[model samples]
Target chain A: MKLRESVIDKSIVQNFLVDAVRKFSPYCPGDLSMATPLIRTGIVDSLTIMEVTKYIESCINTSLPVAKINRESFRTLEALSDMLFDFIKEHNLDLDIDGLKGMG
Target chain B: MDNLGQVLERSINLYPDDVALICSGEQVTYAQLGERVAQFASYFSGLGLNKGDSVAIASFKSIDVVSVMQAALRVDLVYVSLDPRFPPERLKELIRDAAVSVVVLDEFLSQEWSKLEFLPDCIQYALTLHDEKKLEIKSDVKCHNFKEINSDSNDYKRFVPQRKGEDLAYLLYTSGSTGKPKGVRITHDNALAFVEWAASEFEFSQDEHFLNHAQLSFDLSVLDLYNAFLAGARVTLLPEDDAMFFSYVVNLIRDDQITNLYMVPSGIIGLMDKGALMKEAMPKLKRILFAGEKFPVTRLKALLDWVEPNQEVYNLYGPIETNVCTFSKIKTDIVFRSECPIGEAISNAQVALRQDNGIISYDGEGEIVVSGRCVSPGYLNSPILNKSKFFLQDNHRWYCTGDYGYFDKNKVLWLKGRKDNLIKIRGYRIELDEIESHVQDTELVDDVVAVFHGSNSESGAIVLWCVFNQQALDSYGSIDIVVNLIRQKLKSVLPHFMLPKLIKSVKELPKTNRGKVDRLKLKERGI
Candidate 1:
């Protein structure tokens, strides 16, 4: 069931983020484009950020590096997706995008 | 010693070598802090800023930020803090509303307000700090690097200005039901009266260390910062980035040897539940203070059980206008009701139930009013509001808190919720009427009703029900898009916490017999 790092693209990670953000942050705009600012627009607050990060930890089955949580990594959907993609690549996960998405 | 500046001077003379501030693991001594305060005081004095002029800064806790606040006090300028997380337009509006002459802005928050677009004519100076970037302010306002003010120092004449007790110390803005935020003005006498009482009552001293959990704009920070300074105690400034991270906050408390913790119940609730309170043990923390909202009983009991026998817990109560008029130190063995009493009034304050213009005694439940040294001067530029919110009775001014509460036979006060549409979420006050009014200003909707969803404020989110004017769904194609557009419109006017969680488009909002929107009905009939 292991998937190579190359199999996961930036778009897939972005889509995952969009879905995660929508689930936790109800006020988020429906049309979340790649350049949409997450924290600046008040769409994703500290509480929502916590939910999103916890979701990522659960999906990865490991603790996300607590120190890696910074403002730049969450500037926009594109940036957040890149961070997730990099996390997957760095970890060399045994699952692909769908596996990351889980059964929900 | 006429003011808080004298208090700082006294502390410096008493313990020059003692650490006064701890931020990012760097320690600042009392003498060093005294020099920073004097440097800024001399600079501000050199400028033509009136003694009572306002200084606006971002509400981030840091060594320099605290120093600037002290310097303002030293020169008798009123201090104010604007949360940088708020939208640029809103921040600009606050600056204009308060008539701020000087602003200390963080360079990293450029995205939020780098280009305030148009500077209000009242602004005379802006200090760009927190980073190396010389962030450009595209305005006629004189901009300077905050760091350079220290380096470009001239002969610093150290002197504390003489100020009457009634001179304004700071202005804290809270959500107003009248569709705009109102500034609560605190004078030195108003603040010092409370600080002196609380520091002595709570026993804050040189050995104790308090954590700056509340935002600088919040009144809670007054309790932490002022008390520490008055007692020659140390304060650990929590960085904005690590604020919500419970693990990090708990770790900081343990690592920094923080002895005192004061925060809203919501923050403490999160820290207790998610932060793993027992791990990286904080034995140095001796006193825990909670305020702003009610703490759930079960979680509170668990927290009380977890702490050591020496650690004391207290529930402090007050609105922004009255800084902690009442507090209850919880006794672990006392059996509980569904709610705990808010305790008796602090020294220099009198608490009672009031009806009409008269004060009522222990039995009757009416609007909670406090008359004493802790009362704010009044709202800024709000004569009509000042007339209604504050009143002279029995030759003493009393601030009407608008909260309905009664005292039991034990002389303990219990809260009975607010009489207005104001609500608190994570200690940030939101006026539901303000949201509805702003949404109506857009004119895209025929009517908008804002209601809280969920059982209580601790777990609830704001929901807006709107009836579009015409062709709204057709133009937007979907309800989601319509809601998004409305939210996008609202971001510029309101703070992030005040934004509605969900927006629903309905043909007509339900109304009561009086022809007013039935908010209770809307809250009951959830989407």
Candidate 2:
């Protein structure tokens, strides 16, 4: 049996995450790097995280599993996007890149 | 007898060993808490602070903070709760307004004290709550550590000053519509009436572990702290950092077996959105009380379905001027018309609706006016506001609540909107809340805010800002699609004049410090 290789576009995921953060947290200053801590830097607290997660789930067309809905998965833009990509690959869900680009 | 200090003293005598406070992984029994208050009271007496004096507390919620508050009341001093989150300038403004002589602050905020402009002249003594560092004191101010104060011997006879029900107990500053914070003067009687009613209505007992999630500065915390202490129940103060993370708060609730919770609607909504309540069956949660803002019926229903069927839920309503004058037990079989009705007045309060013609009505919509012991003594040092908001009618003092509501035939109060929220467009008056209610009722939206833009004339237009739910967003891929759906939905339900001219989709609605929608900020962002 041969294992299938996974092909993920990092830029697409980064763009989506950045746009979502900006939309949810309009008061967040300057640019948010992929490694920037969302909670530590006060970009999103418990209240605003709800909006960010909801937007991500809507874009991905999948609800995050109960276990994945936690601080670890949402610590940073990179962490969240990586989790989303992993979930997509595990579930073998189709990603409509064009649709997401237009939405962002 | 109506003094808050007497209530604490009675609880200490009745339940000495019972846990009174739980914070920072430590428990303080009623006996220990009482002792701490006594030591602090004795120390204040040594400093010549007596009845009617003001003590400002600028710190996070903790056992020490509550002890100091109780001690101030014990010594007949008015305790002022200030938010540590505020800047030094704002704190100075409040301290000057209250004429605070002594300030108790957390050690973490000691550095910010240097930035204060009025502290040099206004503050006579500074007591640090946490750290024991021999620190620099500016303005020749006397500073004391918390440990030393608590360990100080009460060898000298301490005089507990006599106080009346009308004596000021606390001063809480609330943001006003006029761009300044107004201090609401609450007397011993004003708080006692509400606390007494809550203890009876909620059936508070020592077995209940209540969660204190509100900031110490917010009036909602007043109910949580006093009601728990008065009933000899354990109050678990959720740390400031823990409150910012939903999972942490959920874990704390589960670990502590928190039986009672009092929060604003936004706090409850945030927990619900994180699927906190849905994750497990909180059998220990006996009751959940939400106040300070409107509870959307959809979210309330979701919460009811998530929690245990037998658990009680209450929707309370009151401004800071009159702390929680009305409450409604959200019955399982209850139906909502637009939003949840704020319900009837509490036992100690009387609710009346007055029309524009100065006539009180029972069944029609009018301004909500509350009377009785729950009403505060009026705004502190704000005579213009006092003259307008507080009134004497039939030998009774009534507070104009600024909220418009009507009493249904069932004697229940249904809130319409704020009186100032009324907007005139093209010579027609429209309630902004009514439009927002219709928008929230639409299946596509989770929350909605309707704001009037431009001058209140023929040129003024109504703008509707909405946040679509996950389902709606997933179904409709773009903002244009969501806007079109909402516009169509509103067109069918609203009249031509009530229809919103602009439909905007926001990721989230801006919220005020009290967690209500910041309508002022929305208005500033014109159409």
Candidate 3:
């Protein structure tokens, strides 16, 4: 199934962060936030980043350009949501950009 | 000292006309190679070279380099094959670290080394000819024609006879989390054990022609060179240039009928991208071994679809410290999956999951530890690393692989990811902390995190997440510029195998509550 931003909102990403932190990392969901760090706090790793990239790509139904594959684009749930929205808009991509924007 | 020479002598006496080495347009037979190795040993002894000394062989991957390595073994000396592309500073450092007394360089690389600060400890330098019409050896260093040194009498005494199992064979230095590279010491017994297992597993034979494309410093070469020799198989060394090497492999497969080929994921990807390897050209390839990195199961399926279904495709996984201890031989009927199974340990090896307390036999998801004859002696001169990594249990020296993996109830080993701050590129181990160190060394860089955005090894790309002091982008010119400087500096010290393919600078590096760089946060931020 194609991945859509509406289907995989900041909550889905946040949930992934929660599960990742609990499973692979030492950090527990003391207080999850949009700006909470996932990797530095030992909640995620570089290998996890590959899985996240794949998850985001499948949800959006388009390739994520290398330029957008960095920390700022992945800073937080809000940051990732906005970046996906912008990515969908820039390529005239196949997604609901306005809906994604409002959700962000 | 005479053990290697005696083996070659015996092989030559039995199979004089058997093919020894296959280069682009040259193929040397066993008898001729035996004479050449013996002649060089005589020349070295004539110059008063003794056992336990180090010799530096600087050249690209070619038949000459293989001959030099065998000759070094004949004399019971550890040979460090310095990558020709290494800057003089790195080369000199390795030469000094290994305490090399002699050097044999290709004519082209010799010109580059001539410009370096020649150490007082080195006694002689010989220049090996690449093309015909050899150039004169350098005047500053006691020079010998490496190729023509074989003209000496074949009646020669072997220099060292006590080539024990504990004798040091080679030194392969890898990037450490700390700045300096750490040498992994491989002994003769450990190397021979791995080679013996590999030779039997591949069913290598005197009739099979094996391709040796990996660099000498890589552990894969141990399987390629020594394993092939153990089976009396002809080894065709692939050149270093990408295009030339790929084209050459195609021709070698078609012309030489190479029966066995082992390569990194990227190497196979390049061939598949060019569509250069046709079924007709690779008909004799009984086995295609991929190791050092994972090949996507989809790509492996495509390759299998391209060739005969019965042609074995094996995915091998082993930390270099353990000499490729576990391997998964893909079945033709098995459908492809995204996650490749690393398979079970080799016959002589045992793999177990160790807890934080170092006890073995955790059920799921723990640090992978290997114990066998295949395991390395330890990191050279790093007692601290030895204390942390090498442990004794049940009268066996166990190597902490630092990789996270678990075994299914069926005993199939599945690798998860590394527990350390490192990544494997083309089978060469690189510490991610090493890259962060370079990034942090840049001007106005407060903190940084290097993340592996590329999922598979074939892609060979990484994106760096950076946080700067007041948008230092203008000073560094661009993110690529800062990356280029790091590459330039690293290239001088580390080989190309360690360089990152891409870089991305961000306003801030995402950090966890602990204040360390948060890699998952960087992923979420899309940095």
Candidate 4:
């Protein structure tokens, strides 16, 4: 059976996000709960913002326009996932795995 | 050396037609340059200018500016650069502090500021060419064409210096931390010490072509300009815009066969970003030296990987008070997350660590104090500061450099950070530098800054401000992942309270006039 829409396992997305953060920020680690304020607390300066935004756009298979990139979507992981999902769904995507998996 | 005039005469006798001064497209040979300076020196003397008097040279870094500076020196007068970019208030203050007797400015800036009356200290004001007609009525001060003065008296002679060493050559002011600027009375001996050291240390050949990028007001420019003169090497003074352009720099190096490059980290990074070396910009480039700020390890590593292994990269460190005091040469292969060691002190200089209690030691982290011929006499007119900071200890005067660092067992000096940058947050004292260290350590993060802010209710408690890496976010889009990474890293080294309550990533860190990270502006903008 084809994996139904909304049947996504978030574990894959979460783990990939962690690895990506670790690779980009070698000085900092990749745990999500602890790094919630990466944007809010002033950890991600402008140079890192552009770099991370480009990376996120490529992974989600969508062009993240500069205008859409704001504090709301960049504030947290949950917000970013929702933004990415909506961005994908607007194009009439078939599935939204528990917010992860199968992309790589 | 008292032999400056003699050397000039010798150079004129030998390389009469060799290119000496090149401003824009205009070129003047050694003989012409020598003649021009002597003529100008005599012209100033004919006007009754005395030794020890201050003459303000307010112009861009052109050949004329260099000629005027040398003329002032030859006539035994101190040459002060009236930087056009300096704030009016600072300029006025410097005019008063230095007791400047004459002011020389170019045409463009003179029109905008010709009417503003300087303080009573400045007695004469003259405009360089093109502004001669702008001033409707001139004061009692004598004004003459800088160019005409040189061409008029080819046979003019100057009364060369009878006294040499302790006589004040020029007053280079510190960047002014405590509201009032402090002038460092750099003697002839002090300037010559660094010039002689660099000329010998670099093995400056007669064939080497040099580039002068820094402003004359900056002490670093002294090394660039004088080192060239010391070696009798040809120097090309780069425009500010051209120095900032990677393509232009590459072209200049390749076409001019520029053999030596002494610049700040920004210039180096710009060239790297433009892939200047990827196209083989300068096949003849041999030396690369960067100073003023810590060179980013990531950018430096990539630059080293791209450039020739034989091309030397020297990390030169020193405060304005000491002229290029310490140097650490890095091998192309060495990679460091933190700042490279300031290296061992240069020849004839001694760097020692002084703790709060004032014990000089070699090992422990403390204030990096320098005691040697390189030390400035102290601030002019500020006796209190001179008494406190610049003190005679063990029969020698030492300038207490506020920077904090320690010497390794191998005798290499590693700077930790600034001592004055400590902040108290919620009863926990934290060095703002510690946050910077963490930021630099993070690979995903290109730039990070931690600023101390106070809550609306509390007056002194600290609020944390941060900016993260943009490149990482584009690839990962995981804010939680980055925060978690930083939190985990800090959890082991920093206490729980030290963790920033708010994490906000921005596009860039604000920089001040000196290209240093500005926290005050960040606080004003908020997260």
> Which candidate gets the maximum DockQ versus the true structure?
1
Tens-place lDDT digits, model 2, residues B324-358: 99999998788899788899889999889988987
Summing lDDT over every window of 10 consecutive residues in candidate 2 chain B, give the lowest-scoring window.
Answer: B150-159
Candidate 1, after superposition: displacement of residue B333 in Å? 1.8
Expressed as tens digits, the lDDT of each residue in B1-527 for candidate 1 is 34755666777888888889888777798888888777777778777888899999874667888888888888889988878777677777788889999888775564345645787889898777676766577788887776666544422245657775889888998888888899999888888888888877888878889999888888888878888887889888886656767767877788778899999888887777666676346878888999987887887888888777788899999999998999898988856677777889999798878876475555668899889988988999899999988888777788889898987778788888888888888888888999999888877799998888875555689999999877777877787777667888887688878888778878898999999888888888886
Residue B227, model 4, lDDT? 70
Write candidate 3's Cα lDDT for B185-242 as tens digits.
7777777677667867887777888888777777777777776666677888765542
Q: Which ten-residue region of model 4 chain B has the weakest summed lDDT?
A: B455-464
TM-score for each predicted model, relative to the true structure: 0.92, 0.74, 0.76, 0.67
| Colliding pairs, model 1 | none
The deviation in Å at residue B139 for candidate 3 is 11
Worst 10 residues of 1 chain B by lDDT: B150-159
After aligning candidate 1 to the native by TM-score, how far in Å is the CA of B195 from where it should be?
0.7
Q: Poorest 10 consecutive residues of model 3 chain B by lDDT?
A: B1-10
Candidate 3 segments exceeding 4 Å error: A1-104, B1-10, B118-141, B147-151, B156-160, B242-248, B306-309, B335-337, B439-444, B468-488, B524-527
The best candidate by lDDT is 1
Error of 1 at B506 (Å): 2.3
DockQ of candidate 2 against the true complex: 0.21
Docking class of 4: incorrect
